[model samples]
Target: MSLVYSTETGRITPEKEQAQRPKGDGIVRIQRETKGRKGKGVCIVTGLDLDDKALKLVAAALKKVCGCGGAVKNGTIEIQGDNRDKIKDYLVKQGHTVKFSGG
Candidate 1:
């Protein structure tokens, strides 16, 4: 049971809480994916336990360091091209435990 409407306020609606991201194991993984983009490789970074804003910031930094364009999707950062080595260096410099996953 909840109050849908109130006389004092027109159409009282409940606040929508932000969904929480699942905690990670403190290890960031960088993997290369090329299945969907017609052989265009995209570096998929995962295992970063960060909120949306922080995740975007990290993605931006990675893109800048790699000198390419990228986007943050589903709590994972996708950097254009195979920039694993560059990303690994940057993440390591940021003090994050980075691992290269898959072939």
Candidate 2:
């Protein structure tokens, strides 16, 4: 497996095969929720390969594009708000096959 990093972003993809897999390929669905203190809400992007460095790159790109604070944990990218379209567009432009889930 080869590790690839996006030139536009500093995010890294550890394995090429895993990154090209169909199981969880693409921009994920995001849901908004106001939980925890001060009712701070967040958007959740799931079905990603957490251990893969490529996914980390994807997460970082999404975060930068949305200009929001987020993280990659539990194999999911959690942004601060709904940014499905932005993430999808960015992924497509980066030349990775993307599959969008949820409404």
Candidate 3:
């Protein structure tokens, strides 16, 4: 009998790369409020690693999972609406260590 095992070569496919990226530590607070000219309560995801592309990907994934509109700016993901629990749960399921911040 022969056994086959895959080693950690850090080689991941595009789909897998998107699915398996490690989310940084800390509780990302989701803030829904109309700030400045944007007259809409936007869900904001903060406390992410300071990486441009990573932030964008995280925001996109969260938006897809929550079925809402969002964008990444100033190192925060501004999702539309208050889906804090949903986003946190989704991130955790996606192999990310998540924490909840704010009330």
Candidate 4:
């Protein structure tokens, strides 16, 4: 076992690493969530089996298509506003199996 504190290094601690997202089941699901962010609705895209860089690229393309500002958090892409239909169309064009998860 390693000591939590070290006299020579002051407070010894491990470096924080980026969270690793689990692999998806091939099917992609898109849902809308507004629990946080003061009631602003965001489309949550999940089940994309892509790495962080690729995920960001996909998110950028989605944002461009929807003409909105959004972000990639964890393994999901959150697009601003209610753009389900537009997102679905784009994903379909990209040859992805997309489905609306929540109502």
Candidate 5:
């Protein structure tokens, strides 16, 4: 169900403003996982501080660098195969603090 706004208050109101989430810290985590795809692998990057458009741009760039496909799902970047080092270096160049997690 959609929210119902009173005619007197209109669409622009303070209630919507309070729902936006604050940007994340500069830290990003790169992890490699392979348990869910019948031996196929993926690198999961989380803790991005940008909005949707920015995140999509970042994902595209990483895909180019890694020479593989990837997607930004639920604010996290999931790249095909293992790319922890490449992603870390790229993020570092972009001025973000990155950390490697998982095997």
Candidate 6:
């Protein structure tokens, strides 16, 4: 066991992050979450094995395709709206294994 969080910086280093994501058979899961959004919806994309920079790049492409505003936080990509099907197709065409969850 080793310390991943740097007390001086008050954050976890890249190598030891990603502890929040639950992993399984290696497929990305895109789900629509509206629980805390005041009735609006946002697509939560998870299970991507990408570092911050790479994830941002992918998020940019998805945002372009969806034509909406979003952000990447805590290793997950949040796209604005219920664009799960569209995103699934785009990711498949881009060679990423993906799955959809939620309504």
Clashes of each: 0, 6, 1, 0, 0, 0
Give stretches of model 6 more than 4 Å off: 1-24
Candidate lDDT (C-alpha), each: 0.95, 0.67, 0.71, 0.93, 0.87, 0.89
lDDT of 6 by residue, 1-103 (tens): 7566786877665564545555446788999999989999999999888878999999999999999999999889999998998899999998889998877
Q: Candidate 3, which segments miss by more than 4 Å at Cα?
A: 1-25, 37-39, 95-103
Residue-by-residue lDDT tens digits, candidate 4, 1-103: 8678888879878778877777788999999998977999999999999988999999999999999999999889999999999999999999999999988
Candidate 1, overall lDDT? 0.95
Number of the top lDDT candidate = 1
Q: TM-score for each prediction?
A: 0.80, 0.53, 0.61, 0.81, 0.76, 0.77
Cα deviation of 89, candidate 6, in Å: 0.8
Local accuracy of candidate 1 as per-residue lDDT tens digits, 17-94: 877677889999999999979999999999999888999999999999999999998899999999999999999999
| Candidate 3 residue pairs that clash | 27-99
- Report clash pairs, candidate 6: none
Off by over 4 Å in 1: 1-20
Better of 1 and 6 by lDDT: 1
lDDT rank, highest first? 1, 4, 6, 5, 3, 2
Please write out the lDDT profile of model 2 over residues 29-101, one tens digit for every residue: 5556556726766777665544669768877888889998888766677778767678768767866556654
RMSD of each: 3.2, 13.5, 12.8, 3.3, 4.3, 6.7
Q: Tell me how far the alpha carbon of residue 18 in candidate 1 is from the true structure, in angstroms, after superposition.
A: 5.2
Candidate 3 per-residue lDDT, tens place, 1-103, comes to 3234337645444433332334655555555566773676676777676588878888888899989998887778888877888988887787666665544
